[model samples]
Structures are given as structure tokens and as C-alpha cells.
Target: MAEEQMNFQAEVSRLLDIVAHSLYSEKEIFLRELISNAADACDRLRHAALTQGGLLGDDSSFRIRLKADPSARTLTIADNGIGMNREELIDNLGTIARSGTAAFVQQLENKAEGANLIGQFGVGFYSAFMVAEKVEVATRRAGEDRGWLWSSDGRGAFTVAEDADAPARGTRIVLHLRQGEEEYLDAQRIRQIVHTYSDHIAVPVVLESKKEDEPDETLNAASALWTRPKSEITDEQYKEFYHHVGHAFDDPWLRLHFKAEGVMEYTGLLFVPSQKPFDLFHPDRKPGVRLYVKRVFITDDCAELLPPYLRFLRGIVDTEDLPLNVSRELLQNNPRLAKIRQALVKKVLGELKQKAEAAPEEYANFWETFGPVLKEGLYEDGQQRDTLLALARFRSTTREGWVSLADYVKDMKPGQEAIYTITGDDPKALAKSPQLEGFAAKGIEVLLLSDPVDDFWLSMVPAYDGKPFKSVTRGGADLDSIGGGDKKDTAEAEQQDEAAPGIDALIAFVKLTLKDQVKDVRVSKRLTSSPVCLVADEGDLDMHLERMLKAQHQLDRSSQRILEVNPGHAMVKALAAQVGKDGAGGVVEDAAWLLLDQARIIEGEPLPDAVAFSQRLSKLVEKGLLAG
Candidate 1:
């Protein structure tokens, strides 16, 4: 066929521009990307050979070879793997076919370290332009007779043509090195780059010099890093393998390497990254783990390999039992795959539990990085909820660092019946909540849950270790039954009870004045220093949940909250006295609204009427000054 020119997809053009100009911090990463792509091609061929007996044809051995010519200013990467035909070449290279192309480009434009985003979007092939002025690819698909050539300058357009003299099967990429990028033409430099990035690749990477007399050298270990026995793999090897697989620079925080045999045979080399991925919480974030059958790579972005909650986990799961021809659709409903997933989840949670028990400080660090993500399992994976809960950690009012539910229970005061907690968006703000003043006074601990997932998991999991999880901001905390506070508090409570008539009148007056704003008005046992606070009704959504729902545009109207008053506070006492004399006058009415607005402010809620609140405060201050 005659060569045809085509414009790159709009998104692809933008990506090419970024690679050619802006993404220069990691120019060497271009080599890594090409080698990784070559390895993937080899893996695809191996998997295809399982069903199509003739796919391998005469050359069954799969390998990647690199040749450099310093005099010619050229470098070639060749792979004996499944290669693309003419149409496949155009579709794959000329367009951004992925779902999140726009988001990926926006991220690339926004982030300084956006080289990883290219890999995430599967467009690493274009990275060659970082060092090459022009790139050429000649490829022939297995079981096909025709070969094709694709050439591009990493700009607006590319060309595709027929190449009769291409390799029998697989791809060869020739890069015309740009000026000042001649380092890639050295054989030693090529070998070092391959060893650093592609050492864990299962296929052999052979490096050859342009000189005819020099012998070719294998640059990589040419073995699957996970399949090797644990004792044989050194820490540095494991760390390098993690860097290659994860496309990350930091060392792994935790590594789980084990082979599960008997019925379900698989090897898992999972890593918990020391640094969280940039898109860890992105709604469309790609899965990090790859799926392999008998060391033949299948899919790296398969969500079936791990649940969404564990999407941060990066590594490989290679199974010997699964058929090499298994498709992703078939794997989803496959009972064997289900069982494997279940077992893997259990194994990961078990390792985390062991780490928490044996090395809490280390586990705490892991939790600090991934706790919100891990807590998602508590809501999503009901079958493993108990295990996830056991692994959960929280910041508490009683301690300096993180504390687990078990640790909190161990330190619980006598007669404490439930595990108390408070949910908000910030830990520092939660610690200052008026609702917790009473708990602090009684020396009772409260878990400070600030993550958006906190409210969700707590709803799914109401209790841990036989004690029900109680929110300190709820109406049913029942602090009196927990046997807290001192005798002085008891005597004051009795004295307030003797003045019950006056308190009751005050509560009635406040309820009448703020009838629509509050569900009810009552004396608060949960307030020690703060005069007023808001609490969710017995069966209503808590303040945190309300705020979250509103923020998401899911809830339009706020749920009415119960307004509680502390009779011991001077403000409440003065309001009660004024109410007894004048019977719900203007001063008493203003005080009632002021108290509600103040409580809302303390709970991090926006006042219903800020202008009114300011006016009321000004009037009260003026009156106080005149009386003084």
C-alpha cells in the first residue's frame, strides 16, 4: 500500500507536544517505557500461543533486543512478540482511545511530575520523542503474512505504509536520536538503563553493539521476580522490582510475597507504596495490579484482580490454575476467579493485622498514608468487614498518635459501655467540638473521625469487639450511665434539678421561639463548659453526614437538630431567670436564637442568618455595657 499521512488525534497531539517539550525531567524514562512496551508485546504473544498453536510459527522463543550505533546516531528496540498490523497501528498510535483522555491531559498540564500520567494512560510509546527527532516502527502480527511500517516525527502527523522486508513476527522501533541525546547510542548506557528499569521483566532483553565482532549481552535477569523463591530475592532486588512495576520512585512500605497452593495456585508479589499515588482517590483511577496466568501477562488494568478499595496496591498476581485463554468478561463471573479474589483479600488483611500487632509503629505509618482508602473496604466488602475493622486505626482524644479500636477498648474507663466517636472534616476542629467538652471533663476518650469515608464505614459497621460505636454528637450518648464526672458535678446536677421548674420554663420558651429550627429543646448532660450544642435526633443523620450530603448536592434541606442547653452555664442561667420574670420577652427570644446560632458555629455549621446573628450580638453587648 502507498504511504498515507494522517493527523494525530487532538488529544494525542497535545500529549506529543508535552512529551517533546515539557516532560524533560525524566528523559531516560523514555527507554524504560519502550522496554516495558516491548515486554508487554512479548507477553501478549506468549498468551496467544496457548490457543492458536501456529501463532508462534517457527520462532517460539520470545525476547527483546536492543542495538545501538554511535556513528549512525541511531538506536533500535526489537521484540519477538505480538505486533500490530496496518489498521491496528493507525488506531493505536493515531488516536487517544482510552476513556480518561481529557482528564489525563488536564492532569499532565497541571502537575509538574506528569510523566507518570502518560504511562497511566497507555501512551508511553510517544515518550520516544523526548530524545528522538524521528521514530519508525516496522511490525508484523503473528499468523499474518503482511507487514507494515509506521513513521512519525512526534508532531501533528504520522505516516503508515507497507513494509515487505519487516521481521517475520513482532515489532522493531528505530529512533533517530536528536542532537545532544547521543548517550542512548552507547551500548553500556543501554545495558544500564535496561537493567535498572526492565530487570524484573520475565523476557530476556539482549543488548548488541553496531560492531559486527562484539558478542550480544543479556541486560536483564530475564526471570519473573515474583515467581522466584523469597529467600533468593534480595531486598534491593525487591525494591528495584517494585520501582519497575509501580512506576514509582519511593520504596514500598510493605511487601507481601507468597505462593498460594492447593486447589488455587497463584503467586502474589503485592506492594504497599510508601508514598501514595497522585490519583489514589480519583474516581476513574486505574487499577495498579497486573494479572498473569503462568507468568504470561494478561491485563495490568484489570479491576477484577483486586477490589476498588485496594486499588492503591501495586504488583502482580500470577496464577497457574487459570487458563491462558481466559477473557476479562469470563473472569469476572468465573467462580475460580471469585475464590482467588476472596482469598487474596483475606491474605492482604491478615498481613496488615499481623503488622499492626507486631510492628504497630510501622503499621501506623501505612495507615496514615492509606487508612482512608483501606476503610473503604469496610463499606464495600461486607464479607471482610470484621477483618478490616480490626485493622482500622483512629486519632483519639486520649492519645498522642493513632489508636486502634482494640487499643481504645483496652484504655476504656470503668463502666464505659460503648465506643464513643465524633465525625467531622478536620481532626483539629473535631477536637474543639463543644460536644466533646463533657467527654474530656470525664476523662473519656472519643475517636476523632475526619475522613469522608469515616461516616460511611461507621454506618456499615456499628460495633467492634462487642461494643456499639456511639457518636458523641448524637442524642443517645447516655453519659450519665457511663459513671463519669466528679461529686461536685453530681451536687451541681442535683441543685439544677431542684431548680427544674425554672429550667423547664426556659427550655419551653427557647423551643417556642426556635420552633422550626430545632426538633426539640432539652437539658444537656453532654455539655460541661459549653453553654449550648446541637445533636442529631435518635434516628436522624449526624451533622457530619448532613454536611457531606449537602456538599455533594444530594441533600437540599438540612435535617432539624435537637438543641441542648447546659443549665450550669451563666448564659443559660441568666436566660432562664429573664424568662421566669417576663415570660418569653424580646431579650429571651433574642437569647434563644443567639444560643442556637452559637451552637451551630461551634459545630462548624453555617448560621441560618449571619446578619441577624451579628445584629443580635451587637444589641446584647450594648445592653450589657449600659447595665455595667
Candidate 2:
């Protein structure tokens, strides 16, 4: 067939430009990425061979070969694994075909910290362009007869043509070194890069010999890092292994390596990354931890091996108990697998607790990245809710940074019965919520929950340490039992309360005026700065939850919310006096609707009737102008 030329996918083209031009600080990273991809291809072949006969044929052994040629100005990385066919080459190399490609591109484009992003999105092939003026990939897929050659110059276009002499059953990538990239041509430099970054890769990485009499040299340990004893492994080895297994560039925040015996025998090498992966929250994202049985590759995407909440964790879990040919269907209901998962969860939570106590600052950073993900356990895994709750950290109205539930309970105001919280889309906005004013004034702290998962878990975890989780925007705040602030502020509040003699009459008239618009209109014990605020009725869903459901189209309509008026506010007092004198006339009626809309706006709820709100607001402003 004639050579076919094609323009790179738009996203891939843009990515190649950024990777080729700007990511020079860590140019050596391209070697690690290419080596990692080579190792993964071998693993895929190993796994595929388990089911298919003769897939490995004569070459049952797997290895990655590196050849650096100074005279030719070329470096080749070859892998004896599952090589790509023509379609696979174009789909995998010529395009960013994954679900989060746009997001991945944006992340790399925006942050220099995205150096680790290369291998993560399966776009690491393009990283070869970082040092190479041109790249050529020659491959023959395992169990296939045809071979293909793909070449690119990192400008805009690439060509794929049939190769008459490609490798029998693997891929070979040749990088034509750029003018000043002679460093990559040095065998010693390639050896050092392999030792630093690809040493933990399970596949043997052999450096091809340049001299006719010299033997090829193995550059890596060629043994699985997880299978080795923790005492024998160095921290650098573990980090490099994480880079290999996790397809990650960032250092691990924490690593857990342990072997369990007795009922079930298994070894787990788990890592929590310092930076969250771009697809951490993608609904279709699979667990990063690969599962192996008795040191043989099984599958990388076994959701049953770990709970979805812990999906951020990356590494491997190898078990001696599971059969080597275990299928995905059996994994779901396997009792032994269930026990292993439970033990794994307990171990991880225990380690996290120790870290939280020993080095709180470091643990706080981990929480900021993975806390929302971990909170999913509260709703899904009731068995480990207690441990997850203990490890959870939250921002609160009275605390800077994150506060634990234990800390929140310890600092509760005198006579405060429940653990107060307010839920919203933003933490800063939740802190300024009018529903929190009275609680804040009384020195009571309210947990400010902003994550969407917060609402789901709060429902499952009704109470903690014997105190119920109470939303400040739900029911009566009951802050009256909690003592007020300093004597001066208390006295001033009392004076304003006494000045508003028409408050009771105003509440009655406003309630009648907005009968259909609100569930109830009552003088609030929770309001101080704002004239009015909205809250969920005692029996209704929390305001935030209801709004969230409506937004998702799960709920057809929202339950009517209660409007709480601050009796001490000057505007409320004036409106109250007018209601008493005018007897719920047009002006007071307009004020009632306008105040309701203002409270809705403050709560971040969309006004039910925006046109009516605008008309009412304009009329109120015009009336004041005319009366003046």
C-alpha cells in the first residue's frame, strides 16, 4: 500500500507543540515515558497470552531493548509485547481519543507541574518529539502477519506505511536526535536515565551493545519492585515504581507495602499521589490499582478489588490465593477477594490516621486532594464509615484551614446540642451565609461543606460522637439556647428587638402575602446582618440537597422553603411599621415579594419568576423615588 499522510488530531497537534517547545526542563522524562509504555505493552501481551494460544509463539520471554547510535544520530526503544496494528497505531498515536483529552490538554497547557501528564493520557508517544527531530514507529502486532511503520516530524503531519521488515511480534521506536540533543546519544547517559526512572519496571531493559565483541547490558533490575522486601527497596525505587505503575509523574504522598497471611495470602503496594490525576472524578474512570495473581499479570481494571471511593489510589495488589486464570465475573462475588478488600481499607485508613497525627501538615495536603473522593465511602461503605469519618477534614466557619470532626465537637459552644453545618457550592459563600450569622455570633462553629458528595454522606452519617449533624439552614437554628456574644453586642441586639414593636404584625402580614411563594414566614433567631434568609422546613430536604436534585433533573420541583426575617434589621423594622399602619397594602405586599427574592438570591437559588422579581424591584425603587 502507498504511504498515507494525515494531519494529527487537533488536540494532539496542540499537545505536540507544547511538549516539543516548552517542556525542556525535564527532557530526560521522555525516556522514562517511552520505557514505561514499552513495559505496559509487554504486560498486555502477557495477559493476552493467558487466554489465546500461540500469541507469544517462539518468543515467550519479554524484554525491552534500547539502542543508542551516535553515528546514525538515532536512539531506538523496542519492546517484545502487544504491538499495535495499523488502526491501533493511528488511533493510539495520531489522536487523543480518550474521554478527557481536552481536559488533559488544558491541564498540560496551563500548568508547568503537568510534567507528569505525558504517560497518563496515553499520549506519551508524542514526548519522544521533545528530543527527537523525527520519530519512526515500526510494529507487528502479536498473532498478526502485517507490519506498519508510522513516522512524524513534530510539525503537523505524519505518515503511516507498510513495513516489509518490522519486528516479528513487537514495536520499535527510533528517535532521530535533534541538532543539540547529542546527550541522548550517549549510552552512559541512557543507562543513567534508565537507572533513575525505569529501574523498577518489571520488564528487563537491555542496552544494545555498540561494539561487535561487546555483550548487551541490562540497565534495570528486571524484577518487580512490589515483590521485593520493603527493607531492600529504596525510596527512589518506590517513587520510580509509582511512576511506572501509576503512569504518574508526581511523587507519592504516601506508600503502603505489606503482606497479609493466615486466611488469605496477598501483597499490596499502594500509593497515594501528591497530585490528583486529571480523570480522578471522571465517572467512567477505573481503579488505578492493577491486580496480579501469584506474580502473573491479570487485569488493571478490577473495580471489585477496591471500593470506588478509594479510586485515587494507584499501585498493585498481588494475591497468591486467586487462581491465575480468574475471570472478571468471578472476582465480583469472590468471598476471599471481599476479605482482602476489607483488610486493605482498614490498613489504608489506619496508616492515614497515623500520618494525620504524626505529620498533620502533610496529611492536610493529602486531604485537600483526595478528601472528597474518600468521603464517598461514608455513603457507600457503611462497614468503614467510622474510620473514614475520623480521617475526614473540613473547612468550618470558625476555623482556618481544615478541622476534624473531633475538633469541631470539642470546640462546640456551651449548651450547643448538635454539630452545626451549612452546605453550598462554594466554601467562601457558605461561610457568609446569613443562616450562620446567629451561630457565629453565639461563638458556635458551622462546618462549611462545598463538595457535592458532602450532601450524600451527611444523609448516611446522621451523627458523629453522639451529636447529630445539623444543617444551619434547616429547621429552627435553636441558637437561643447558646449564649450570645459580648455583653455590648447582646445589649444592642436587645435594643433593636425592642424598637421593632410591629415585628409580629409584619410577620403575620408577610406570611399571608407570600402564602404560595413560601412554606412559612417567621421571625428568625438565626438572622443578624441580613433582613431575611431562606431555610428548609424541619421535615423537608435540606435546601442545598433539594436545589442540587432539581439542577440534576432528578427532582421535578423543589419543596417550598421557609423565609426567616430578621426583626432587628432596620429595613424589616420600617416595613413592619408600614404593614401595621397600612394594613398589608400594595407597598408592603411588594416589599414581601422583593425580600423573598433577595433571600433566594443570597441562598444561590434561581428566582422562580425572574420577570416578576425585576418588575417588583423596579416598582419598589420607583415608589421610594416618587414618595421622596
Candidate 3:
């Protein structure tokens, strides 16, 4: 067949340009990426061979072969696995056919530094360009006769042509080294790189002898890292294995390795990443833990193996009890797998509990990254709700860092009966909420929840310990009963109430004027600084929940909220006096609406009628200025 040349995809061209110009700090990663791809191809063939006969052909032993030719300035990585045909070559190599390609490109364009784009985007094949001036891939897919050659110069174009002399049953990638990249061609350096990055790979990585007199060397252990004893593994080995299995750049914050020797036996080697995965919140993202039955590859994604809340975990679960040919559907209904999942959850949660107790500061950092994800269990996994709640942490009105439910309970005021919380889109803004002012003044801490998941889980988890969770933005705070208040402040508030004799009449007048827009208008015990604030009625939805539902289009309209006026504020006192004299008409009517709109704006709610609000504000401002 004739050679066909094609321009790279726009994203791929951008990627190649960055990569060829040394996008990565560590050039040795080129070998790691190639080896990982080679190992994946081998694993695929091994799995396919179970159903299809003769896929492996004569090369039943799957291995990755590496040859370095210093004389020719080339290093070759070859694998006898599931190599690609012409179309597969083009589709896989010429495009970034993955979700979040646009996001990846945007981040790159924004100069995001030290990113593992190759691993994160499934474009590891292109990393070869980091160290090579040119690359050539020659391969024949397993169980197919035709072969193809793919050539690229890392200059935005690649060519694919028929290769009569391609490998019989796999791929062989040759990297023509650029000047100063001679380290990759050294046997010792090649061995060191493989030991550092690809040692955990299950496939054997063979390094060809530099001289005719020596035998070819297998640089890796050629066995699954999880199968080895935990005592035999070092921390560096664990980290390298995590990078290989997780396809992640960050180190593992926590590593769990254990063997379940009970009725349904399995071995699990899981790592909790220090950094969140790029697709952790993607709707289609599933757990990346590979499942192997008796060391035979089954599938990389088995959602049934772990609860979705623990989806951030990355590694492998190899079971002796499950069938090697088990399909995904079968895995879902498998009782033994369910048992394994339950046990794994318990084990992980227990380890986390220990870690939280031993090293709280470190665990707090982990919680910052994965706490929102772990909170999903409170809503979805009923059996583990208590454990998840204990593991939870939050920012609070009184504290600078994360506080646990246990710590909050311990620090509760003498007469406090509930776990107070306030939900919003931002913790910093929530801290400044007028509704929290009275609580803050009384030294009562309220939990500040910022994650969207906080809303869902708060509904499922009604309380922590024996204290019911009460939103500060709800009508009934009963702040009078909570002890710990400045006696002088109480006396001053009482004095203000006496002096502002029109406050009750003003509340009644405002209530009648804005009856259609508000559930009720009343004086607030929760307001100390702001003139007014909004809160949900006792039986209505929480203000934050209502706003969130409306924003998501899940709810057509928000529940009416109570408008609470601060009796001590100068503006409120003056408005009350005006209402007392004018009796609920003209200027008082506009003031009533303005106060409601001001409260809404502070609460992050949009005005119902912006034009009317503007007109009323201008009229009021003009009247006040002329009087002054």
C-alpha cells in the first residue's frame, strides 16, 4: 500500500510541540511511558487470549524488549502484545481521543507547570518526543497478518505506510535520539530507569546486550507488585507502583496493602493519592482499580469492587475466589465481590481513623482534597454513615482550620443543644453571614459548609452524635437559651428595644407590605451588625438548599424566607420611626421593599425586579440627600 501522510489533530500538534521542546523536567520518563504502554498492550492480549484462540500465536510469552544502539543513536522498545492495525494506529496516535481534552489544552495554554499531561490525558505515547528527534513505530496486531509503519518527526505531521518486515505479532517503537540524549542509550541507565519506573509492571522488560558475548538482560522482576509480601516492598517501590497503576504524578498520601484470607480471599493494594485526579468529579469517571482473578487480567474498571465514594483509590484487587472469565455484569451480582468491597471499606475507614488520630495535620490536608468525595457515602451507604460522619471535617465560625464533629461537640457552649451549621458557596462569605453574627458574639461556633455535596449529605445525616444539625439561616435559633453572652451587650440591646418604641409597629407594617415576597417579617435575635437578613421559616427548606435547587433548575421557585430586622440598627430604628408616624404608606412602603432587596443581595439572591429596585433606591437616596 502507499504511504499516507496526515496532519496531527490540533490538540495533538500543540501537545507534540510542547513535548518535543521538553515539556517534562525528567527526560527518563519517556522510557516509563513507553514501557507502560507496552505493558498495557501485553495485558490486553493476555486477557483477549482467554476468549479468542491463537491470538498470541507463537509468542505466548508476553514481554517488552528494549534495544539500545549507541552506534546508530537509537533506542527501541518492542512488545509482543496487541499491536494496532492501520486505522487503530491513526485513531490512537493522531488524536487526543479522551474526555477533558479541551480542559487539558486550556490548562496547558495557561502555563500549568509540572503537570503529568502524558499520563493524565492518556497520551503517554507522545512522551518519546521529549527525548527523541524522530520516532518510528512498526507493528502487526496479534492474530492479524498485515503490518504498518508509523513515522513522526514531532513537527505536527506523521506518516503511516505498509511494512512487509514489521514484527510478527506486536509493536516495536524506535526512538532516534537527539544530541545530548545519549543517557537513554546506556545499558546501566536503561536498567536504572526501568527499575525506578517500570519495575512494578507485570510484563518482563528485557534489555538487549550491548555486546555479542553477553546474554540479553531482563531488567524488571516481571511479577505483579501486589503479589509480593508487604514486608519485602520498600516505600519507593510502593510509590513507583502507584505511579504505574494510578497513572498519576503525585505521591500516594496513604497506601493500603493487605491480604484477606477468609472465606472469600483476595489481595488488595490500593493508594489514596495526595492530589485529586483530573477526572475525579467527571460524571462518567469510574474507579481505576484493575481487577485480576488469580493474577490474570479481567478488567480495569469494576465499579462493583469498591463503593463510588471511594472512587479516588487507585491500584489493583486480585482475588483467588472469582472466575478469570467473569464478565462485568457477573461481577456486579457476585456476592463474594460484594463481601470483599464491604471488607475493603471497613479496612480503609479503620486505617483513616488511625491516621486521623496519629497525625491530624496530615489527615486534614487529605480531607481538604477528598473530603467532599468521602461525604458521598453519608447519603449513599447507610451502613457506613456513622463512620463517614466521624471522618468528616469542616471550617467553622471560630476556628482557622478544619474541625471535626467530635471536636465541635467538645467545644459546644454550656447550654447549646444542637450542632449549628451554615451552608453557602464560599466559606469566607459564610463566616461573614449576618445570621451568624449573634452566634459569633455569643462565642457559639457554627460549621461553615462550602461543598455542594454538603447539601445532599446534610439531609441524610441529620445530626452528629446526639446533637441535631441546625442551620443558622433558619428562623428558630433560640439564641436566648445559649449561655456565654456579654452581659453588657444584652443590657444595651434591651435599652435599644425600649428607645426604639416603633420597632413592633414597623415590623407589622413591613410584614403587610412585603407579604407576597416574604413568609414573615420579625425582629431578629441572630442579627447584631447588619440592619436585616433573610432566614427560612421553621418548616420551609433551608435558604441555601432552596437557592441551590433553584439554580440547578431542580426547583422552579424558592421557598419564601422570613425577613428579620435588627432592632438596634440606626437605619432600622429610623425606618421604624417613619412607619410609626406615616402608618405603612408611601416612603415606608419603598423602605420596606428596599430593606428586603438589601437582605436578598447580602444573601446572594437575585432581585425579583431590578428596575423597580433601581427606581426605589434612587428615590430614597434623593429624598435622604435633600433632607440632609
Candidate 4:
């Protein structure tokens, strides 16, 4: 093949510029990225050789070699693995093959935080430009006689040519160091970087010195960390392994290292990050785990390895029973994979349960960061719904910190029949809801749920520990049956009750005036301080859920709400006396509409007509001033 010159993809050019100028803060990350890519290539070749028989040829040993020459100002990384051919080299190195290029670039422009978008996009090769002025790649694909050389200067164009002197079957990347980047040519520095980052890689990473007197030395441990016995690994080794695998800077919050044997054999080393990833909620965020079969890398973005609810976990799962040639299509819906997933989920949940019990404060911190995400399991995983509900932590009107459902049940009042809860967008706002007034007066506690997922999970999980979960904002809440009020308060309530005929007339007149605006008008036992509040029907959707759906354009029409008036309030008593003196007239009708509008505003719902509300209020104030 003749040498060919081609222009880099437009996205590739933008990405290279970002990498060279702003992608990474530390220059040593270039070596980590290159070594990680080399390790992946070696793993791929091992997996391919399992079925291809002679693909390994005479050189069965798989390894990576690093050579640095201070005089030449160059550092070369070589690997005996599944190398790319001519077309593969161009497509992989010259273009942004994965999706979301535009979004990734936009993130770079918006944030000054140095992000590892390379791993997410599979463009770690371009990271070489961070420290190198130019890069040259020589590779020969396995089972092919021809080889190719790809050379680029971190500019808009690159050249490819046939290389007859390329190795038998692998890739060698030579980076020409920039002026100030000559420190990378130091052999000791290269060894230290490998041990710090790639020590857990299964392949041997050998460093060849520039001095003739010193022999070649293997810098890394050359064994899979997960495959080793748990007792043999030190805490620092485990932490370093997690840093390398997760591409993260902080230490892990928790680590799970275990092996399942007998029938299905697999080893898992999973880590929960101390802080959330920047893309934790990104719609296109890839999976954090990598799958392997007998220590050979298979796929890193396989969703089948773990349920979507646990996507925050990062680690590797290597199984001995899976076929070396298994493809992702074959792994999906496979019974073996399903069984492994089930077992892994159980183990993860059990570990979390233990942690929550042993360290309450630490678990509370974890919940603060990931509770909303974990609550998703209640709706998605029915089989584990009970476990998840029991594990959930909630904020309540009575507690100083988070309380579990079990603790709430245990702390139930003497005759409390159900667990009361209220949902909204903010906990502090929900705490001031008029619907909670009566409960507060009676010294009853209600859970204040503010997460978006809280509305969903509460609907799916109706009850816990034989006590039903009841929403305080719904009409079905039975405060009387729950022994909420005492005899003395009941007597005080009777003294304040409106005259029977006057109250009856007041209810009838208000209902008639607001009939078109509300589903019904009735006296309320749930409001102690407020004059009126809104409540949903027993089977109607939650108020918060309805508002959310309407805001999202998923619901076109608003559901009618029932308005409940507190006869004990001074405003309601005055309204009743006024209605008894005069029949339902325009003034009385205006008052009815104003009461309903106020309730709607308190419930976080927009008024049906804001202009009418303002006009009516202004007229009432004018009439009051003239009379005074």
C-alpha cells in the first residue's frame, strides 16, 4: 500500500485541540491512558486467540514494553495484542466514532473542571497529544501479512503508509516529546507512573532502560487484582486498583471484593465512589462496569451486567464459565448471566444493609448523595421492593435527621393506624403545608418526601410492616380513627363550632358559588390554623405528581380538587355569618372564588385565572375601606 494523506475529521480536530490545551491537568495522565489502551489490546487478542487456534502463533506470551530515549527525546509503548489494520487505524484514530461529540465538546467549553471524557468516548488515543508534539503508530493485525504506520502531528492532517518493518502482530506507539515534556524520557519516572496506575493490569508492563548496563525490568504486578486472594491484597493496593479502574482521583467510599464458586465461578471487585460523577444523571452516560470472561476483557458498556438502578457502581466482573468468544448479543437474556446478575444484586444490597446498621452517620451521608437514585429500585425491581423499602431513609416533621421506615413504624403513636407522608419539590416548603396543621396540633409525625422519585416509589409501595402508607394531603386520611385528638380538644372544638343552621347555610351557599371550580365543598378536620386547603380524591393521582406531569406536558388538563374549609378559623366564621345575613350574591361569590384560589396557591398549583383573582381582591379591599 502507498502512503496516503488525509484530513482529520472535524470533530477529531476540535477534540485534539481540547486535549492539548485543556482536557487534562496532569501531564502524566497521558502515560496512564496509553498503558490502559495497551492493556485492553492485549486482553482482546487473548480472547480472540481462544477460538482462532493459531492466532497466537509462536509468541503466546502477551505483554507491554516501554522504551524511553533521553537523547532522541522520544518514548515508545509497544504491546503484543490485537492490532488494527489500515482501515481500522484510520477509522479509530482519525474520527469520533462514538456519538455525543457535540455534547461532549459543549461540556468542555462550559466547565473548567478537568474531565475524563476520553474513557467515555473511547478516544484515549488522542490524549497522547497532551504531552507529545507528534505521535507515530506502527501495527500489524493478527493473521495479516501487511502492516501500516499512522503518524500525526496533533494538527488537522495525518499520514498512513505500509510499514514492512512492523512487528508480527501488535501495535507500537512512538511519541516525540515536546520541549518541556522531556521529563517523560526518564526511565525511573516511567516506571513510577506504571506502578502507580497500571499495577493491577493482568499483562506484564516491562520497562527497558536507555543505559546498556541495566537489564529490562517489569514494573507492574502483572496479575489481575480481582483474581488474587483477598488476604494477599493490601488496602493501598486495593485503593490504587480502584483509582486505575475508575479513572477517579478520590478514594472509594466502600469496596466489595469477593468470589463466588461452585457451579458458577466469578470474581468481582466493585467500588462505590466517595463523590458522584459529573455525568451521573446524564441520559447517555455509559455503564461504569467492565465485563470479562476468565480475565479477558469482553465489554465495558454492557447494561446486562447490572440493573440500571445500580449504574453508579464501578468495577469489573470476570467469570470462568462464560465462553471466550461470547458476544454481547449472546450475553443478553442468557440464563447464566441472569443468575449472576441476581446473585450480584443480592450481595450489593446485603453489603449496604450491613453498612447502614453499623455506621448510621456514614450511611446518612451516602443517602444524601444517592438516595434518590436508589429509590428508583422500588418501582423497577418488584422482586426486591420490600428490601428497598426497608432500606429507605426519610425526612420527617418530628425527626432531627433521617429515619428509616422501620424506625418510623416502631415510633408509631399508641393508636396510630397508618404512616403519614407528604410529597413536594422541597422539604422546607412541604413542612409548611396547611394540610399538616391538624397533624402538627395533635403531635403526629408525617414524613416529608421531596425527591422526585419519592412520589413514584410511594405509589408502588403502599404499606410497610402491616401499616398502610397514607398521604396527608388526600381525603382518605382518617385522623379521627388514628386517635389524633383528645377529649379536651374535642370539647374545645364543639364550643367553637358555628351555629348549626348558620353553618349548614354557609356550606350550601359556598358549594353553590364554587360548584364550577371545585369537585366538592366540605368542612375539614385536617386544618387547624388555615381557613381552607385542597385535597385529592381517594383514587386520584397525587397533587405533586399531577403538577409534575402537567409541567412536563404529559398531562393536558388539570384534575378538579376538593376544597375543605376549617370552620374553626376566624375567617371562615365571619364568612358564615355574612352568608347567613345575605343570600349568595356577587360579594359572596367573589369570596368563594378567592378562598379556592388561595388554597390552590398554597398547594403549589397555578390559579385558573390570575387576572380575575387580582381584580376580585382589589374590589373587596376598596369596599372594605369605604365601609370603615
Instruction: For each of the candidates, give the backbone clash count.
Output: 0, 0, 0, 0
Q: What number of backbone clashes does candidate 3 have, counting pairs of residues 3 or more apart or in separate chains?
A: 0
- Candidate 3 weakest lDDT stretch, 10 residues: 109-118
Total backbone collisions, model 1: 0
Better of 1 and 4 by lDDT: 1
On TM-score, the leading prediction is: 2
* TM-score on alpha carbons, each prediction: 0.84, 0.96, 0.95, 0.84
lDDT of 3 at 403: 95
Q: Which candidate, 1 or 2, would have the higher TM-score against the true structure?
A: 2
In candidate 1, what are the lDDT values of residues 445-505, reduced to their tens digit? 9999999999988898878889998898887557665666566765565564455347888
Better of 3 and 4 by TM-score: 3
Quote the positional error of residue 555 for candidate 4 in Å. Answer: 4.4
Worst 10 residues of 1 by lDDT: 492-501
Give per-model CA RMSD.
4.2, 1.9, 2.1, 4.3
lDDT of 4 at 286: 66
lDDT at residue 40 of model 2 (Cα atoms): 91
lDDT of 3 by residue, 1-628 (tens): 9999999999889888777777777889889988988998898889888878989766699899999998999999999989999999999999887778877876655435535545765677888998899999999998898999999998989999999999998899999999999998989999899999888889999998878999999999989999998888889989988888888778899999999896888999999999888778888769878888899888888889888899999999999998776776888878999899899999999999999999999999999999999988998999999998999999998989999999999999989999999999999999998998788777899999999888888888878788999888886669778888677766655564564768888899899989888888888888777889999987788888888898889999768788989999878887877875643367888989999999999998889899999998888788782143
Candidate 4 on 1-628: residue-level lDDT in tens? 7889999988888888888784676778688778878888888888788768888899999999998888888899999999999999999898876566676666655435435455444566787998899999999998899999999998899999999988899999999988898889887788788887788888999998657898889999999999888999888788777766776656788999989999999999999877675467667646788889888888888788888778778899999988889976888888898988999999999998999999999999888877887888998899998888877999999888899999998888778988999999999999999999777766788999998878888888878998998999887445665554556665555554544336667778889988777888888877777889999988888889898888889999877788888888766776676775544366667888889999989987777799999998887677672143
Top of the candidates by lDDT: 2
lDDT of each prediction vs. the true structure? Answer: 0.84, 0.88, 0.87, 0.83
